[model samples]
Target chain A: MIEEITSTQNAKVKKWQHLTTKKGHQKFHQYLVEGWHIVSDALAAEQPVVQIIATGEQLDAHQRELPENIETFEITPEIAKKLSDTVTPQGIFAVMDILASETIDPETATGAWLLLDRIQDPGNIGTMVRTADAAGFRGVVFGNGTSSRYTPKVVRAMQGSQFHIDLTHGNLEDWVKALEARQIPVYGSALNDQAEDYSTVTPQADFGLILGNEGQGMSERLMTQTTTNLYIPIKGQAESLNVAVAAGILMFKLNQKLA
Target chain B: MIEEITSTQNAKVKKWQHLTTKKGHQKFHQYLVEGWHIVSDALAAEQPVVQIIATGEQLDAHQRELPENIETFEITPEIAKKLSDTVTPQGIFAVMDILASETIDPETATGAWLLLDRIQDPGNIGTMVRTADAAGFRGVVFGNGTSSRYTPKVVRAMQGSQFHIDLTHGNLEDWVKALEARQIPVYGSALNDQAEDYSTVTPQADFGLILGNEGQGMSERLMTQTTTNLYIPIKGQAESLNVAVAAGILMFKLNQKLA
Candidate 1:
């Protein structure tokens, strides 16, 4: 039904805003998604969409394609703007239940896994998830200080990779130890003098590659716990690389080692 | 010299705003820089520093290290806030001369060169430059419709690669033709049946790899000009990658071919 929402005081508006906070996201296990591309991607992934709100114009453009049982409503432009985190709202929003996090059952471990250590930028985190998904990584784990996977900017940038990977948030040390316990080698990238060149490292059929913060990189304690330290050699003038770019290069190159 | 700049018409204030425009940066042959890391990197790169401005308590903390030849000024907190593009000014700003874009004579291009075709995000462009620099690309060219190299955000994101590479902005088609004339293989990344897997095709020592716009990717006309079309095989659930990340994978892998 085309329901008109004009008041900023609407319960839905407040709930969407709450999704912006990590506590709200964790407590409710839901995320707010905006724009046509994200909404379309989420639906196509068969995510448990709690509700769909569209502007009158947007509904006219898209209603014919929506599922009959979907909870859809046509909201006012003002209401849509209030619910949007983007500078230019696309006149659509969705409340989606969190995708089930992938369980690290050792019995099913066969491919590579990506571990993010305190990656702070939401955009970088989202891009990494997208790249990891494109490269066919088994799953992604966010360490302490990492951006929340449910942040709006991340959700927008990820497009739809959220549903495709087993995403988990935990302490890096504990996760590495857990992976170690399972007989998986844990490798962390370091700018250390003696680290093996990243291109030279062979990817284990079952391994965890840890990427660290943009500034501090992998913490000293975490770096010490890794079975091996990998370094991407710099041949030109940049002292370092953007964390996401470096991680993507390593993930793709490491995958090649298997082939 | 401490000067209270109340009027928005002040010469220095006007110059700061002008740097935002391409015409202004071209006329002055320099641009504004913001924040501590960018300013520090620019200084450490030993670029020609025209001036440094600081304000508030942070100015006191930063003043002891000011070099004699470089001009220095102190602005009121209000003035600094007005001049800053960022939400929180880090009590520092610098004006540096733009490095002259020296053309890479075609005969000397013995390594991978990045040919960007209308890539637009400043952060994406900057990140690509840093990655290209790290991968030992000969240079990075900003083709038609690309963002200016001197934009503050691009310069900051580059983290000083601008001082280290041949970053030129001009006719991309002409450059493509020139490289082809020299028998240097120009590989265009495109989605076409003619495209071979990027890993399958060994890059010639003399090669120019072309990247396209973020949205449309390589244009049909540009694809026609390529010596060959190459594709990075996507094995996962995501549709595609951020253009810069894709470029990094190509640049680094292609550089490895030469190594």
Candidate 2:
């Protein structure tokens, strides 16, 4: 079914405008993804995309590829601009169900996992997710204070990597305890006397790596809970590495051929 | 010496405003850096900080620490906003000379260097430069299409890394040729059957690593001219790593230790 929305104040348009915020996505349990690439990726991944919204021209361009079972709406440029977060709207969007993520038990968990604590930057969060995907990690746990994956800014920066891996919201403290109970080494990144030099730690078949806030290192409680903390020996005068960059180096180094 | 400027229309104030653009910065051979942190770092590095501009409140806060020889201007908050690039003006700025970067002869270049081609994003450029600093690289060369490091957005994102290492603008192709001529391996990053896995290459004491535009890989002309090209294995579905992240991974991996 297809409908035309000429006015910005239309009921459906107002509802979508709300999906631009985290609060709205949480309240309605739906998320909006913009641009052609992401929309097409969502469809390709067989995500639960319920609706397609586009300008008449964009709808005409993409109509043939869109799933016929999904409802479609042709909206005016005004409404498109009003709902867009980008400087120029791509004139297309997909409304998706925010599927609840299931928890993975550490006792049976295999492969590597990344745990982020209090990572507030959307770009950092999204980049880390993408890096984790590229590094072939099993999943990423967003600890408290870390921005939700549903945040529109993170969704945009993620560039579609969210669908490629598992993302779960959890308390990092509990995660550390659970992983440690199973004897899966959980490593926190920090620079201290006791921290093992990262390169010296052989690639592991199963592990959990923790990264924290941009300004602060890992939380005191979480840092103390890990099996051991790892440090990338800083050879230069730079105080530290960017959190996302550090995540990439550590994930690739530790997750090599997770057997 | 201190000068009080009450109005935005003051001749000197108008000139400082001009430094906000590339052309303006080029014409004057000077650039403006905001915030107390940058200003102090510039002073600490003895980087030819000719003038300091700050609001009365900020000037009062930082007065005792400022050098006696450099000229200081106490401007109103209105003038500070006029010259600030950030939403909330830090109310402080330093004007520094754009020192001409002498060409480095590859024969004598001892440490790893990063060469960038067509990297237009300011944040990516700044982040790469900082990563090079953290990885203990000797310098970074901006090829033709990369935004100048003097751009206000790049300067701000660079934090203080700009002062810690050398920044040179040059042709990446020439850099590849020069390094190879000196028996130093110049590596290009590309994913192909023939490209050696990045991890297989042992950390080197002297080499050049080339990164290109975010979307496009290294230029065809440059790719074929390298000593050899390297590839970071992407074990999962992510198409590619963020340019800044890739640069970080490569720099740290190759420049692990100078010896």
Candidate 3:
């Protein structure tokens, strides 16, 4: 049934607003995905979309893309604006349950995996997840200090790649040990003399690539535990590459070796 | 000489504020670089630092790094906040004159050149410039519709690489023709049947790599005129790579081919 919400104080509107915060997301086990593209991607992937909220105009424009079986709410433009974070609201949003069941056991992981070490930026974290999916990596592990995967900015940046890959949150130190115990070589990205040139390393079928915080890079303690630390050589004057760009280059290069 | 300016209404303060906007930057032929790292980079590169502004604390902390002969201003914390766009003011900024004199003539361009086609995001534009610098590209040409190189956000994201390379603005169509006439192969990044895998192409000493806008890839009219269009193969489900990440991967891969 289609319902109309005119007041921001409506129970359903209040509930959706709660999903915007981390604590609210945790309490309810759901997060909001904005815009038609992300909402449609969730529906297309058969992910659990609790409800879709949009203005009458937006619903009319995207009726063909919306699944008939899913419940949807039509809100006034003012209400839609209150639900959005963007300056120009797309006027569409999907409430999706957190995809935590797909989390993998590092001890039994068999394919390539990406380990993000305290990555702080939502855009960087999301882009890395999307790149990991493009590289055909089996999963992504978010270390302790990283941004929450369910944040609106991150979900927007991931572009629905979360549905295509396993995403988990855990202590990176333990995960590293687990992967190593399974014979999956773990490589940490760093910029020191001890770090081998990334291009020199041969890619393998299964491995763990660890990327660290943007400003500080991989923690020194974590670097010591990896099988080898790799560095991308700078050919020009730029001191370093953006963390996401660096991650993409490394992921694709290593994946190419297996191909 | 060091001078204290307690009021935001000071003539110099008013002028510096103007540099924050596009029209002001154009009128003064100068742009603001924030944070200690970028300011130091500008001074170290001798990139025509017009003046430096900082809170007394920042000036004292960075005394050793500040150029002794350059004009410096000591501003109050309130004034510093007013001059900054970030939530937390870095308390340091440098007014650097535009470095457009180094613009290369495409017909005579002899090194790798990055052509940005209407890329909108300031961060994306800046990261691409830094990546180009790291890849040892000679220069970057800002095509029509690209973000202004001198914007505060772009300058911050570039992380001082702007001082290390030549930045020019011009019509991409004309630039492409000029580069081609000089036998400098121009490559357009696209996802289409006619596009060759980026890995298959051999890197050359002199060439132009065109990256398109975020939402729309390269303009269709411009894509058709390139010598060859290249594609980065996506092994998994992501629709595409982040523009900056894609540029970085392509740049480093192509640069590696030459090495």
Candidate 4:
């Protein structure tokens, strides 16, 4: 039977609201996925979706598409608004479990991995994850100081690519050492005298690419650990390219050589 | 002498606040550039910075960087917060005049040009403009249905690249006709049977690249007018690339051939 949640104070409703924060997400081991597109992608990928919550209108519009086994809750418009991050609530959301099984043992890892160091903007972090997926990256490791992968904004911007790709959180330095021990080249994106032009390095089937914080490039210690650093040359007066865009260019260009 | 604005309702303060909206920006032919990095870039580029407004601390910290001829204002904290779009306000802003004189005569245009069609995200729009600048594109044109170039969010994301490149507004269909008349090749970023892999086509010194709306790509009419459409192949399960990221990849790759 489909349950109805008329009060925002209901235990389930309050618990769902808690998913909005990192601490709550970590404690509950769940995050909220909003909008039809994302929710549909989650279902298609067979991710663990705990419950589908929606307003009466949204339930009527999309109930037919949902799996029969999943629990459903009809919530009030007020409750829907409280749970939504966007101005116009899509009125549909899914409580999804974090991919706890996808953690990588870096010593055993191979193929291309994207390592992010303190990427601050939720949109940039999400876009890089999605781009890494599109470029056929094996997995993504969110280094220290990076935004939480399960943050509502990051989840929204990732557009379900998170389900298709492996994501793990760890110290990037340790991951670098592990990959290096496996004889995989760890490339750092840094612009300095010693950095080689990205075009000069051919993309390999197995490698690790490290991108850095928005304001600061890769930390000096991390850069020192890289096998080599790469830089994208700028021909015009603009000082730098948006980090996400740079990541995209590098990912695709390197992957293109493999093709 | 530096004027002071203690009231949020001060005439100049109110006028500056209005620039935050698209309609007001169009009516006033001005926009606000915030943050020291962007404001300083605007000043260095010799763009028409009508006035420099800052908190007393900011004014004291950056007074030496200001050009001697420009007018200055010290605004109250409340007024600064009212004018800022960010959470932690930078407490610095420049009221910059729109480039009313830089409209393109497409028939006589030469070198590379980036034409955008109905891109809605301010961050995406501004990042594309900045990317175009870094790739040494001659200009950027905002087509019908796109976000306003002078919106505060767009201006902020652009990071003062607007000062380095020629930005204009026009009907893309008209611009297409004009470029075709001049025998300049026009490329559309679209995925269709006729579209070629972007890697196959060499980037030319003089060409046009048109990117489209986030949800719906370039309109059918505009696609029909292009010399050729290009597609960046995705190797993994992800559906499509972020529009700004795709543009960056294309711009730099095409520009690399030029180098």
- Evaluate model 3: give its TM-score: 0.95
Better of 2 and 3 by lDDT: 3
Candidate 3 regions exceeding 4 Å error are A99-102, A257-259, B8-12, B99-102, B257-259
| TM-scores for candidates 1 onward, in order | 0.91, 0.94, 0.95, 0.97
- Please name the candidate that would achieve the greatest DockQ relative to the true structure: 4
What is candidate 1's lDDT per residue for B32-72, written digit by digit as tens?
88776777776776877888877756567866666766887
Task: Count the clashes in each prediction.
Answer: 0, 0, 0, 0
Compute the lDDT of residue A236 as modeled in candidate 3.
Answer: 81
Where is model 2 chain A poorest over a 10-residue stretch in terms of lDDT? A101-110
lDDT of 4 by residue, A5-109 (tens): 899889998889899889888799998989898999999989899899999999899867988799999998999999999998989999998767767899988
> Tens-digit lDDT track for model 4 on B89-171?
98999998876676778888888989999999999999999999988888899998999888778988887788888888888
Q: CA shift at B157, candidate 2, in angstroms?
A: 2.2
Q: Report how far residue A163 has shifted in candidate 3, in Å.
A: 1.2
**lDDT of residue B122 for candidate 3:** 94
Cα error of candidate 1 at position B82, Å: 2.9
Of 1 and 3, the candidate ahead on TM-score is 3
DockQ, structure candidate 4: 0.72
Task: Quote the true-contact fraction of every model.
Answer: 0.84, 0.62, 0.75, 0.76
In order, the Cα lDDT scores of the candidates are 0.80, 0.86, 0.89, 0.88
Cα lDDT tens digits, model 3, B134-159, are: 99998899999998988888998999
Better of 3 and 4 by TM-score: 4
Q: Rank the candidates by lDDT, best first.
A: 3, 4, 2, 1
lDDT of 4 at B32: 86
Listed models, DockQ each = 0.66, 0.65, 0.68, 0.72
